[model samples]
Target chain A: MKTDRTPKIGFGIRKIILALVIPFIIVLIWLYATMYTSIPHGILPTIPEVGQTFVEMLKSGQMKEDILISISRVLKGYLISAVLGIFFGSLIGMYQPVKELLVPIITVIRQIPMIAWIPLIVLWCGIGETSKVVIIVLVAFFQILVNTQSGIESTPKGYIEVAKLYKLSRWKTFTKVYLPHAVPQILVGLRLGLGGSWMAVVAAELIAATSGIGYRMSSARSNMQSDVVIVCMIVVGIVGVLMDKGIGVIFAALTPWRKVENENRKEE
Target chain B: MKEAKDEIRENDNSYIINVEHLNKQFIVDKQPMEVLHDINLKIKKGEFITIVGHSGCGKSTLLKIMCGLVDYEDGIVERNGHAVVGPGPKCGMVFQDHRLLPWLKIKDNVGFGLKNLPKQEREEKVRKHLEMVGLKGFENSYPSQLSGGMSQRAAIARGLANNPTILLLDEPFGALDALTRIQMQKEILRIQEEEKTTMVMVTHDIDEAIYLGDRIVVMSARPGEIKEIIEVDKAESRKRSGAGFAAYKKRIYDYFFEDSDVEYDVEYVI
Candidate 1:
């Protein structure tokens, strides 16, 4: 299984050159769209105009506040979601009775998309920081929970039997056998949940928030300042990419054994 | 069944493991299917016992039952005169796949069952067992870092680490190549000789049974039962290419294939 393959990290110069090709093509299209087309600047800002506005936002400290505010909100909600998801997921995964009792309702709730939860959450928590964080929790929790549950559930029967043969206590077995087996999968969940948090936070801010990057985009949209809107979008994309890479780096360090494979002794 | 119990009673407490009329059933498609029926075995302390049977003969099941890894009803299976309800520390088992936890290093996997000991004592025991299995330099290596034979050696080390009175090996070298398997067989024999621990190995390989076992229990499939028990003279059976080894192989082969149309009389006799 490719399961044991060490995730390749650290882009080479050649790799960086290859990766930048698509973005460069996209920028060429953007420059053409603004300079050559009759489309108004209000609708699609010129690349230079967007870059100038980006510098203005940075100088004003507006860019820093917006990015930091959104990041902090995502972190707060993400941590709470991670804890709740893993705790409940492990219980449901380990026990048949708990899984039977909880899974059906959770499946139904997860069907309702994150955006659909915002109006109701805004009504209940009232467009404050609580509403945004709650919306994020609602969005990210299920993603983390389902992934964690599957990871724990799919632990090899042989491994569990080994633990049982050792007569390890239930808690000890979970920690040593189930938990370690599930770590890589659990990391996948945490990454997805982090991604989900950004979506939830942005959507919540666009619909109701008074501050944050999403709010800045919407306010710029209404004022016909397309350059500011484009700048916010670029900043959001960059932050999301950075956070994703950060999670990869952290989890890689945490699970060193996963990255070490013996070429001569691949498991049968 | 009554005779079986009487036989056990006649035998002294030198027997570390005793099974009288042991029967095990598993439910398949909601039907009660017997895996082991009327199994009677008595193993003395420090004796190396090998159970030989075909695949699907429930030999592995019997080994698991002995080690308290599997439950059985309507059986008198005892380890050290105590009925085995569940797995205990004294009964260590090695499985065919070398079931080492992939996440743990060889040292951690070997020391897994050595609970409630001082740090130094546990480390010492792990080091000793790893050294015993000829895996001295691989303490820091993960299970995947080792080849199949090496992994099985680590598994054997793990089994011995707990200092169990009984070690049950269920086809422990089944996954290794022929040369590696032969090497492993020699290593296990040496380990058993040095430790003097009661070793019970289950295998489908006839030669392995003759080579290592002090007594080889030949079992038949479809509700597995002991067909015959052959005593091996260590001096004679240790010579794998000698006439005595082939003679034992011939006898075990008859127990497995005699009922079938394949003729073995000409091929076996010199």
Candidate 2:
């Protein structure tokens, strides 16, 4: 309507092509390597074979079940950690006594790798999904807590001064000023926590689990079903990308002012 | 025009802010270092005063004291005949840094200090000040999206949105480019004329002091004290580059730059 002179990059065709580039390159290299190589048959499982395996797996709903299990655990563990971490983080952020007492404990726990807790967790909780959830929560909670505290601490002092001068109630100041200021940082923390929990869940499942993508991969490895394992890995990659992009979209929706700023920069 | 405003205010002996024998000393590693010494100054009903000094001078600290943002070692600051304890909405301030909440839109930032007010009223007040600062259409834009001059204007709009009786500006336009700085000075002067709020600005620019200040108060470097207060009778005409403007500029320059031995038409009040 306004002459539409600005050259906008099309997300439709361009995005599809961009998304396919890595897979295309991988398939091309696989085809070329298999075509001229002296590799034994059925051992390498050429690109076409893997594609066939992927279609068969999709049709049989093996991929779907594994994905659902993984997602459910990630969602449960990540959500719980997000709630608890923000509550405790804010408490520590606002009070010096709480911060001094808890910070050292948090730091020590955070230093211990997520995998380091896997054996103990499995032994304590048994192979029931409890251990996997515990691992995910452990990995995610630290990220959420650290980031939330950092976000609260980094809020500008001038804004707080303005709040005090305006005679805003303590609750109002936290909700209106402090909360909005910390949104972007806290969102980043959530993103990191969710992604970290995803990795931890998969690892925990790999070690001890009855069902999940990680369990499927372990079984496929034992049966020498490399194509199935590769398919599971692809599913993991795709799901991770989707989750990250979904969070990014949510960020844009919540903070439209950022979009305006980006458009301004492009004009400049 | 200025004389008429002063004359009208002369009949009402109501002093909005009274500062008496204010002294400030910063304890730097257990050493009592004095910055402001026996600084006794009074701002009447609707006066526009500007303080100009060098970097080390305590102009900023004095401004903090005036806004009750920082405490002084010894002072009696009374607002409306009541002793000042801490920052109140009666005094509004704008720092050199725009200090707009990065996450907030322009309209919301202007309403930041009006958090206690009703939502509809706050929104209306924010709109009025946005229009006053010529940012009518940029209500939804963030501080990051604004130019340096525009952000500073938004900062001024935020300060004035509170509608305080006394406005404290601490070198608000010092961060802008030369051209933008000049434009902002003119904009602020026009706003002050319209608002008629008692204003105290701290600046290091002598030319800026001459351009915007109705009266310039110069402070000495260490243990900052008011060295001279020069009244610019023809400030409107002095803003332009003419002989009268040059004479007034020379008077302030002499007060700050000239040796004590130099003879000038400066009346030392303290």
Candidate 3:
């Protein structure tokens, strides 16, 4: 058995090495261009210079504070949108009257982009944390609502018959049948919403924030500190990837049935 | 009709289910189409009845109406002297697709119908039924993890877990392969004998109808109506290859081909 598994393990490792090769090559080219060539200092900083700036930001605790503020904003906005989206989406999905009443209005509002709302939100709530958070909320809310509605509407007819035959109550049907069926789609919406929240936070901070990664990048741009800007960009990309992976883990944990379903399909 | 009434009245306690003057219609493309016309059926306690017809014969719809999952225009369906207004705990149904919730484990799926019971009692009943279906060790497995046959078994377990008086099955083995279908037939027979639950099943397979049902209800398409009801006397020891079984098969075959618009050419090549 041990000998039989060796080729599979070797194949996985080889694939990982292949995936990393392109990024490694690009980094090498970047290092050569910045260190050896005369590309001017302000245009593009060397990798080590950016790395040094990152270390200094960490030591001074400024990066930590900005990151915390941005993350807290995302959390608050995302939580509110997720709760309301699921609640109202389910109502609209299950009831035709509710859908007819609210869908058109929500669709009209959703057509207006999150960035467009920044001006009005800033005017209403001022250039404070409320405006930035509201912008993020608007960015995240629509995706969750649409996904949740579709997910609920697309529940299998067979499952609905089961619910009817068992005479499940309305609440029980929602909790047991509809909720579990919609979970994967809801998670998809959540992942998309998180990415949107990150982008919106940066935009909001750039427009009207006292302190955040977006503010730091904008300030660095004004001061001609390209290294600081690069450092902030790297930090944001890393955090975004980590958050996505974290949600992926939760998705796998919640939907254990999907694993067996994919395996059955493969066998077929 | 008078004979049926007398029979029902004579053994009021013996009949577990009684259906009379059942008429069902559906609106298709703004046209009113009658599916079942003035149908009547009487099922005794612990009886196994199979309704066999071709596709679009409305046999499934009839079963659904009996299970209270569909509404009928004119009918009186009674179970143990009480009218069946809607679905309740007394009747359990196993669907054609083995509609087990994909998110739930096998144990929870089986125990789903028994949610009104106490926690300990529900778990015990689920365990017993799961063991009955030969799925003792698969309690934690999801429906997707099981084979088609295994999933059908789980569905049967779920239907019986409530210990209902009557179990309605709508082509439960229709999707299974031939071998698995035969095995499921025998498994259902064994379960019916052990539990003594009345079963009303719909199937398009004649052999399945003859092999399992105490009475085979043969129906015709185009506003589906019962053509005949054949009684199987030797339900205890049925032999598919026996001469009696051949006779029954020929009788059912004639009903479909004798007066129907369908034509057959004996010498036609494949």
Which predicted model would earn the best TM-score? 1
TM-scores of the models, in the given order? Answer: 0.94, 0.87, 0.93
> Per-residue CA lDDT of candidate 2, range B28-68, in tens?
89998889888877677677788998877899998888788
Report the lDDT tens digits of candidate 1 across residue range B1-270: 547645765776868999999998999999999899899999988889999999988999999999888898887999998998999888899999998998899999999998999999999999999999989999998887888899999999999998899999999988999999999999998888898899999998888899989999999998899988888877889998788888888888888787853576655553
The CA lDDT of each predicted structure is 0.90, 0.83, 0.88
Tens digits of per-residue lDDT for model 3, A198-229: 88998898888888999999999888899999
Docking class of 3: high
When summed lDDT is taken over every stretch of 10 residues in candidate 2 chain B, the lowest stretch is B261-270
* Residue B172 in model 3: lDDT: 97
- Which DockQ-derived CAPRI band holds candidate 1? medium
Top-DockQ structure, candidate number? 3
Model 1, A1-268: lDDT tens digits are: 2335444233355578899999999999988888788999889888888889989999999999998999899999999999999999899889999999999999999999899988899889998899989999998888889988999999999999999998889999999999898888889999999999998898899999899999999998899998998888888889999999999999998887887653433543
Per lDDT, the best of the predicted structures is 1
Docking category of candidate 2: acceptable
The DockQ of each candidate is 0.70, 0.42, 0.81
Better of 1 and 2 by TM-score: 1
Best-to-worst ranking by lDDT: 1, 3, 2
Worst 10 residues of 1 chain B by lDDT: B261-270
Once fitted onto the true fold, the runs of candidate 2 whose alpha carbons sit more than 4 angstroms away are A1-43, A92-96, B1-13, B235-239, B259-270
